[model samples]
Target chain A: MIKKVVASVQEAVQDIFDGSTIMVGGFGGSGLPEALICALRDHGARNLTIVANNVGGVQYGVGILIANRQVRKVICSFPIGRRQAKLQDTFWEQYRAGALEVELVPQGTLAERIRAGGAGIAAFYTPTGAGTGAAQAREVRSFGGRECLLELALKADFALVKAHKADRMGNLVYRKAMRNFNIMMATAANVTIAEVYEVVEAGTLGAELITTPGIYVDRVVEVKVERRWQG
Target chain B: MQATESVADSRLTERQIAWKVARVLEEGWYVNLGIGIPLHIVNYIPDDREVILHSENGILGMGTRPPVGEEDPDLVNAGKEPVTLRPGGCFFSQADSFAMVRGGHIDVAVMGALQVSERGDLANWMIPGHELGNIGGAMDLAAGARQVWVAMEHCTKDGKPKILKHCTYPLTAPDCVKMIFTDIAVIQITDAAPLLLETAPGWNPQDVQKLTEPKLLFTKPVKVMDLTGAPANK
Candidate 1:
């Protein structure tokens, strides 16, 4: 069986280059791979293409990455901030200055492209952006006798994910809904890094309980408790 | 009735009302339970049923509230409260979840209301004083669900009527509600209009009328019904 080598979070993310496309798994503040994020922040990578469910809270998760000025483009469904007013101000500032390249995808379409990338499919058709602003970069097609928007798969150079548990062989288990973006992202990256809370023995995790198997994972890091923070 | 008198009403206590609402859910029902008082419904779902709970941020197959110690930073409902996932539950794009909602796949949507008009119009996502009142998926859920139900108090905190002749706030759904269950009575909306199906025990139709601002169209005389076992008044 293939095994995942355990290393420190910094070492795991040390190879990431500036202007790389990276997929970070988490929804809002939940299940975000904080260890890898902090490592990237410390690594001082800039002009990054980041994909996530939402920008993490102002001082946590993706927000930290944003604050560090590491992100060049963001593909997401919602804007970031504690309140709508704050979110609006931040968005307006970024947009007016042309500093942020924001691609606003319907929450479902964004998820599907990530899933399709993981599934090894190049592209899929959807009705989600048929007539919306999201149609700008995509090709249109007709499927099943209806007009559908064709979106390309979104794979990245690096994917950082967090899971509740994992074995040396890399089979991962996520707790509850925290599993959101981690499983799909594992297959969608050239180099997938997982920061797991617990690294158990291989085969220790029951077959039914395994969420993302080791075949998709390339690196493993045992996250230190000191870096994890609650929102 | 004396204005100062506290009357024994027949509506289920909040806990009982939540339980009663949960009991009616069937397997595979795509549900959107509104925030506030309606959030309590999640606790009452039977373990055997395969109901898939949906939040606007795009999670499905959501489980009951997690134990206190196990709160994960990542798992949250549309209200931004941490939540648990049932067995076999998987996470997908929130956009896809809304697609399921907008595509008319959801079976039922239960929501809470500040006020509901006699015409079955719903006004729940906002109140005038609130600075931020984003409707989120409420509009889509109301329009897409085959059935829509509103659960709320019969009267406002200051004894003002919530069931109105017309809503004062912006509308969330246009004539979409099927039933309105309050602490005082259960009213059903039909072709003829808002029909008074049942009255709270000890309160007469006249009493309910005085509190309701809308001119109720009651085709038949209202009868009192047993309150579903909600948590007993604390």
Candidate 2:
């Protein structure tokens, strides 16, 4: 029998190595896995490619990894700041200095790509980036009176996510809007580790409310500092 | 031409423009408000209507900005500013959120634009010679939204016309804008061309024409929208 519970974030993240492609879930501050990220940072894994909505601001989220020079590339839609106003982001500065590489994907396209990876679908077509620079060099096809670009699936070696609650079985239920990318990311990664606020007894949590089933979750760890809820 | 004095006297404040945009929102409609001026629409959504606000970050049923003292550190908008979620509002992953957008679940999308063409093309994301260019969610919303509305000033801060015959800047989305609410007028884009639906109070058709690059059709029947009326939510 495969046990899902882990004693510490560092133990769950011990396998991550240099040059690993990782999917870090969350949008801004909503569903970020803070403890696992800190563990990865402390674990000293380098040369990583991170995929998420934003790389994060100056002192938060994935920005810490960039600040530590752990990341080598990023695949995302939005960069750090307001497009018109410009961002003083560490990642942007790194990219400008030729120390990093970036592949810009449209928001919907990025989501579908990750979803496709989790669902075992090879590739799909989307109308979201038909003619913009996002569609650059991709196959263009006309379907049902609309033009679309072919987008490929995105998979990762490890996925780290935050969930509001979990059972000992690893069935998860996320709180509010913080579930961004965590659910899909669970199935897409080779190993998925969840940092939950609390671990309830298996039968105590209803099966229907679980966002990511235990089959998709490899390990679960309780975060020492539980996230605030509905304050 | 009896030009109303107010249009000539002052520029519409950002909050005022947001209030005007709020009036156009329909009750029970799921709306995605883009960054910048459209963000202010949250404060002005009428209390009477139950318009659901969505963020590209995966939150729907978003409420107005919370007071300084009561902010939940975990909750924020696409802009990363602290916000409150409304009753029955829930969060999902980035994939699910974009599914709502690309799947056309959004009823209306209000966004800010740098320039809009007579053909309703939008150029909002990038300009030539910028340091870094990232579009965020505007491209998806513009391409997938049921109805696209632009909320911007009549002219650039340097007094350049934004509504043009053709956008010289890089395009964000082609032929996407259905209506434009500028400080000086409300214009509707149809298959034929831009129709002058209404002029700002105290401004005449000619005054609007002078500031607009494309030739605007001064249709005989036009109304000056009264912003003082209750917002859609109210």
Clashes of each: 10, 11
Tens digit per residue, CA lDDT, model 2, B79-171:
767889898898877777888887899999999999999999998888879855677888889999889999999898899999999998777
Give the alpha carbon lDDT tens digit for every residue of A1-231 in model 2. 556989999998999989999988887777888789888999999999998877775356777788888889888877666432222556567888887787877777888899899999999988876766666789988999899888899999998988888877889998767777788888899989999888888877787787789988888999857354332
Q: What is the interface RMSD of each candidate, in Å?
A: 5.7, 2.8
Tens-digit lDDT track for model 1 on A177-223? Answer: 56667777888999999998888888789989887888889888987
DockQ, every prediction: 0.17, 0.52
Backbone clash pairs for candidate 1 read: A30-B73, A30-B74, A31-B74, A107-B95, A108-B95, A108-B96, B15-B230, B16-B229, B16-B230, B16-B231
Residue B124, candidate 2: how far off, in angstroms?
1.8
lDDT of 1 by residue, B1-234 (tens): 233546653445776666667877888888877666677888888778877887765577776667766765666886567777777666754445656765778788888888888778877656787433444456556655678898888888899999887888767666778988777777888777678877766677788788898766664778775544545656
lDDT of 1 at B136: 44
The runs of at least 3 residues in candidate 1 whose Cα sits more than 4 Å from the true structure, single-residue gaps closed, are A1-3, A81-96, A127-152, A201-209, A224-231, B1-38, B44-76, B84-106, B109-234
